[model samples]
Target: MFQDNLTDLLENVQNGALSITDAVSRLKTLPFEDLGYAKVDHHRSIRNGFPEVIYCEGKTTDQIRGIFLVLMRSENNILATRASSENFAGVRQIAPNAVYYQQARCIVVNPVKKNQDANHYIAVVTAGTSDIPVAEEAAVTAETFGNHVERIYDVGVAGLHRLLAQLDRLRKADVVIVVAGMEGALASVVGGLVEHPVLAVPTSVGYGASLHGIAALLTMLNSCASGISVVNIDNGFGAAYSASLIIKEIMNGCQE
Candidate 1:
């Protein structure tokens, strides 16, 4: 909607159909819209390069639908994380185009399609097959935000050769998101191998001693590798967000 309004304003100016003051007046409300329960920030895409994303876990179905409607009015794409099938049903009532990713637990409305450069991509690596859910969340989030993503799964430190075999593939990524639960050693190993940024995500995929991923979280936080950064336990979305921002900056630099 923002882009459409800007285009209309420019066309109006060219045709002398509207004054500059009128265009400015129309744009003032483009920043935000208040809906009592929520104040949707329409200008977030302008300011942050990405629109606000809905966290559907705590919100009621009605609340999610309402928020999704307001955000869909914008030109930017809409993403709702941690959304259940029921939440998707509510959103689909208003947006028939919306799709639910069961494994990723995410709902995407009017997903943005970009011709991504192969050289500029995010690599999502997992320590075990059990970690793929969390890894998929990270991969989906990064891809939704217009970044090319490559998956390198089940390459834990148990068999160093598996990870070692993918050294060339891992190195090709501009940013690497390492997802693990047991001991969280994969992040450090990837960090040590790559020259690019490493964003580690710990999942609650371990056994009794793992303490619901706390042990892995602590392990990642204390990683000795130089450029290793960690997010909260099971926070694949957060890891992807940080990686997207890093990739965006790199893209901007290349364009300049």
Candidate 2:
């Protein structure tokens, strides 16, 4: 839609059919659409380089469908996080091409085109098998944004050798996202090993003594490793979004 609008504006100017003031007026309204219930920000793509993401957890099925239809009319790609199968069913009524990733709990419509950065990817590492769901959420989020993602699962501190063996792969990433529960020591460990930025995600995967991830969250916040940074508890989506920004900057730098 952005391309279409630009083409139309340039053609009208060449044909002398519309003045510059009229073009500016149309472009001004392109920034946003007021749906009464929700004021959708279409300018996000111009500002942030990505369209607005739909967070489907609190919204009703009808509301989600309405927003989805609005965005679908303009963009080729769309993403919805923390969505259930029922929410996906609602979205499919408007976007039949939508796909639901069960483990990631994410829905994607018309996934973005991949770039040449598949080899220069983001790495998502998990401390244990139980943390894979959160890890998968991070992985899918990164992939949907057109970043290639490599997943390294079950390499927690419990087995030092398993993590050590994957050092070569971890070092190759542009950025890393570590998902762990319990002690959350995996983030510090990976941070110490990799030269890239590490985004730690604390999951609510531990027992009562783990305080439903508070212990792990605090441990990550106090990481001894210099490059380690922490996101909110069980917030795989947030971690991935940060990683995507870093990856985009790195790629842009390389292109320059």
Candidate 3:
């Protein structure tokens, strides 16, 4: 349960509306739930603002389904990343309401309406069309985390004017996620321009010289721009997660 839900339950018990035994029974799964192959972390939403996300890369269909089943009992919004279409199809059998994102290769199950708090916005930019998959991954991941996301695609530095045109939107974002491959110079350029934090995601979308994104990764890591931060090659999820934290900090104005 979330803090508000737990507080309400406690108050109900104190007022004699609920028996202590019943309350204790309800909260028996507060910490976690054992599912043989996995232990679903039900208390994540209580500790963090968001619920736990499933990473479907290395999991079998049955394993994913079992873990998802336990998490669904908690009744929080669910997100699973790096899920294949087949995985989503299996999950959909269990969660009919789940939606699969083809471009991002992610799945989302929303039993409750999402709280679209757009007071804060995150901008996701891509250097070229080839980098769109990673860019979409970052954009969708950020949106799943409850942040309004704006996407600016195919604005590589080769055409500096295209990127310049969106300077106003870039400046307005609470945090910016720049996704690029090849030389991966877009992050440095964006970092130099925007006052907000810039998350650099290098994808494996380049020629042999690119060394499967290692060259771009090194370039981004050595960026002279002060505000640019780098994630692993093609790790859009990591960049999005970091951007979410920055946006949340700016929105809540809390430091910890």
Candidate 4:
């Protein structure tokens, strides 16, 4: 929808249906819009492939709805991370079709399946069942961006056999995101096996000595695997964002 608007604006200028001055007035909201409480980045999709995502953790229900309404006008896929049931309630008031992922704790509005590179896909792996919330966040984010995702859960290193069993499936992904909590060794193991880029998400899902996932974060950062990249603790969204960019590049290069 964001791209559609930009194209429409250019077409209007080219066909002389709208004057340059009039177009400028319409585009004055390009970079951002100030809503007193927040500066909504309306131009985010122009800069990046996806539009700005609402991080609903700290915002009020009214604020989330306000931003959701503004972005809805643009018609792009809308995603709000760390959202509660209350947040979804607020968003649903304006966007009746909005859906909430309970496990992922995310609210999605205008989710359009993007299968430009359906043959290619992302694999979202988790070390244990406890890490699924974070893993779900990554998977949903990728899907919201129109990217295909393969979820492989609870295949941590402790069992070894579980992960080994899914080796064939994991090998086929364009990019792999390994989400782990304790020690975070799963990322290294998967990184060693997969030839593609490996994104490690350290989750806050361990005992007291885990230091609230700091241990896992440090372990992932110091992995012996060559192509492993680590995101912040419980940052499935960040890992997914990077993986989406990788998938985009691969899809574009194939067309070229």
Candidate 5:
């Protein structure tokens, strides 16, 4: 439940079709719910245009389940990033429909259907096969938020021909997410070729000098290409969120 639901609820109140007590029962979960350890923000959908997402990294399984149940009250799409199989089990006990993407380490419950009228799509490109996990994180996150995502994998700078082969498809995207490790040169290469915004994600998939992706992060930060934005090391979710925001703004602008 979001903007439209709120509007409909108010209309029902005004029309006297629903009793005040009954409406109150449905509205109890409006602002948020406090569960000792966490306060689930159900109203985030109204404010951010999307519901609050669960990050199941350090939290206990029970905590994740509690939050998941609270968010489910809103009946909106729910995303849990950095989730493990154990985390999925906790959520699944409550929401049997929850689907988990192992490569992404993310879970989606009640995913919203994409808007078929969307005018543009986002491209998720990875430098190597090893970087596919990070790329999947970005791809799945974008899809969860109801954006069209095109994935191009194993196109590192080591083989510039591979990247060039996908240039035409990359050029058509409204937003491009380049996921890479090692030197992280793929972001710069893709950024130079695309006219749209390019969000870079540096994964922790490299050798000694890579410094657990710090080297790749620095390389992306120092990229020479224009229209390029870099997120944290191994932060696929950040890249997806940034790309989603850019795509949303572009779509909103097109509608106007």
Candidate 6:
């Protein structure tokens, strides 16, 4: 339950539309729900403005299914990351409403009526073709959280002109997530040009000295450009989540 949901519930009670016992029963799972294998945070949306997301890696099919079932009951949007095709098929079988994002290895289900007009837009930029999987992960994660996303792929530092040409589009976004590997210089270059926040993600797509993305991570962290932040190696989901938060803050600020 989010703050709005809880406030509305309380208002209903005070107005005598709902009995006190019934309201209490509905809020019994305000903080969390304990399922033997996992502690589901049902009240995360109430506290954080977004629901708890499920990490599918290293989890069995049954555990994911159980968690998914309980989470769906709350009408909160569902997100499962690092899920395999087989797992997606299983989830689809159980919840036909869920949609699978193959490239990102994610599954999302929307219980609420779709919000056709998205409030904010995010631009996802990638350094090269090899970095697409990570880029796709960031794109899907942001979209799952209700942000409209525009993709700019294979515009790495190797071809600076290509990225320069998109400056107008980049400047229009609420937030920009730059996915890169190798030396990870693209994020710095993008950060220098755009006024919005840039989320840099380093992928494990470089040669031996790349240290499986350490070089990129370090490069991004040491970026001289302002407004650039780096997430862990291959952590596209984390970058997306952070970007979404930044965008949401800007959106809320605009309303004020």
How close is every model to the real structure, measured as TM-score? 0.88, 0.88, 0.85, 0.89, 0.87, 0.87
**Candidate 3 local lDDT, residue 210:** 98
> Per-residue lDDT tens digits of candidate 6, residues 31-88?
4667879988876775566788889999988888888998888755699989998888
Task: Count steric clashes of candidate 3.
Answer: 0
lDDT at residue 223 of model 5 (Cα atoms): 93
Instruction: Give the number of colliding residue pairs in candidate 1.
Output: 1
Which is better, 4 or 5, measured by lDDT? 4
Rate residue 148 of model 2 by lDDT.
Answer: 87
Query: lDDT scores for all predictions?
Result: 0.89, 0.88, 0.86, 0.91, 0.87, 0.86
Residue 195 error, candidate 1, Å: 0.4
lDDT of predicted model 5: 0.87
lDDT per residue, candidate 3, 199-242, as tens digits?
A: 99999999999999988899899999998889999989889988
Candidate 3's C-alpha runs over 4 A off are 1-31, 111-113, 117-119, 254-256
Tens digits of per-residue lDDT, candidate 4, 1-256, equal: 5557778999999999999988877775554667889888886775676789999988999999999988898766799999999999988998999999999999999877665465799999999999999999999999888898999999999899999999988999999999999889999999999999999999989999999999999999999999999999999999999999999999889889
Q: Candidate 5: worst 10 consecutive residues by lDDT?
A: 25-34
- List, residue by residue over 120-168, the lDDT tens digit for candidate 5: 8889999999999999999999999889889999999999999999988
Model 1 agreement with the true structure over 1-256: per-residue lDDT tens digits: 5467667778997899988887666655563566777777776765677788888888899999999888887655588899999999999999999989898899999877877888999999999999998888898899889999999999999999999999998998999999999899999999999999999999999889999999999999999999988999998999999999999999999999
Worst 10 residues of 2 by lDDT: 24-33
Q: Rank the candidates by TM-score, best first.
A: 4, 2, 1, 5, 6, 3
Better of 2 and 5 by TM-score: 2
Tell me how candidate 4 scores on lDDT: 0.91
Error (Å) of candidate 3 at residue 177 is 0.2
